[model samples]
Target: MAIITVMVFILIGIFELTPLIKKGDIKGFAINLALLLCSCTVLTLKSLQISVPSPLKPIENLIKAIIE
Candidate 1:
């Protein structure tokens, strides 16, 4: 399951990067690769039954404090 999940992400990353590579857009490729790596890591961890924390909690608390 983990391997399959990672492979899918790898394929998606390849498809995403091919166009950027063809256009010689190094910046775009780098940004996309970073995002792909982050998402892939998160998804892979989830597949392995790891708990992921929500980064939005702090932001949500800040917003609530400002509003209230």
Candidate 2:
């Protein structure tokens, strides 16, 4: 799960940064850098097995209910 989270963050960071880098927008580049840092922090938390409640768990249960 931690690997999955890291991969997702990396993909998102690349997606966000690519356009900014292409446009030569330094501010956007910095913002994306900050986002990358935050994502890394999250990845580190996951690596440490710091469990937390799933933010989407309730939504998932709702979907399951509808499906059932």
Candidate 3:
């Protein structure tokens, strides 16, 4: 999961940062890539636990309450 998230972020970063990278701003590119990778890793780790609440569950409950 963590690896998948990092890969996704890296791909997105490459696409979005191409302009800055092409203009010789290697530092900005590196920093953004590092940040993206770190964020994805953290989020993936957080998602690994089985007991975490599903984000949609609350919304579903609210809708059910309204319907009933």
Candidate 4:
């Protein structure tokens, strides 16, 4: 499943990101690549059953600490 996701993301980058590079839009290229990488990492982690802690946990703890 992770392999499948990677291949799919590769195809997507070839198609979608090529235009950004060809047009010399470095900012657009960087943004798109970041988004692609983040999604791919998350999906790959999910498929591998690796536990990723919730992003909001720290915020929740901070709020609780503040209230107390």
Best by TM-score: 4
| lDDT of candidate model 4 versus the reference | 0.94
lDDT of 1 by residue, 6-67 (tens): 99988998889999999999999999999989998998899999988899999999999999
lDDT string, candidate 3, 1-68, tens digits: 75677678778887978987899898987888778867776677776753545679999999999999
Instruction: TM-score for candidate 2, please give it.
Output: 0.58
| Runs in model 3 lying further than 4 Å from the true structure | 1-8, 50-68
> Could you tell which candidate, 2 or 4, scores higher by TM-score?
4
**Candidate 4: which stretches are off by over 4 Å?**
none
Angstrom error of the Cα, residue 41, model 2: value is: 1.1
For model 3, what is the C-alpha lDDT against the true structure?
Answer: 0.78
Where model 1 places Cα greater than 4 Å from the true spot, the runs are: 60-68
Error of 4 at 38 (Å): 1.3
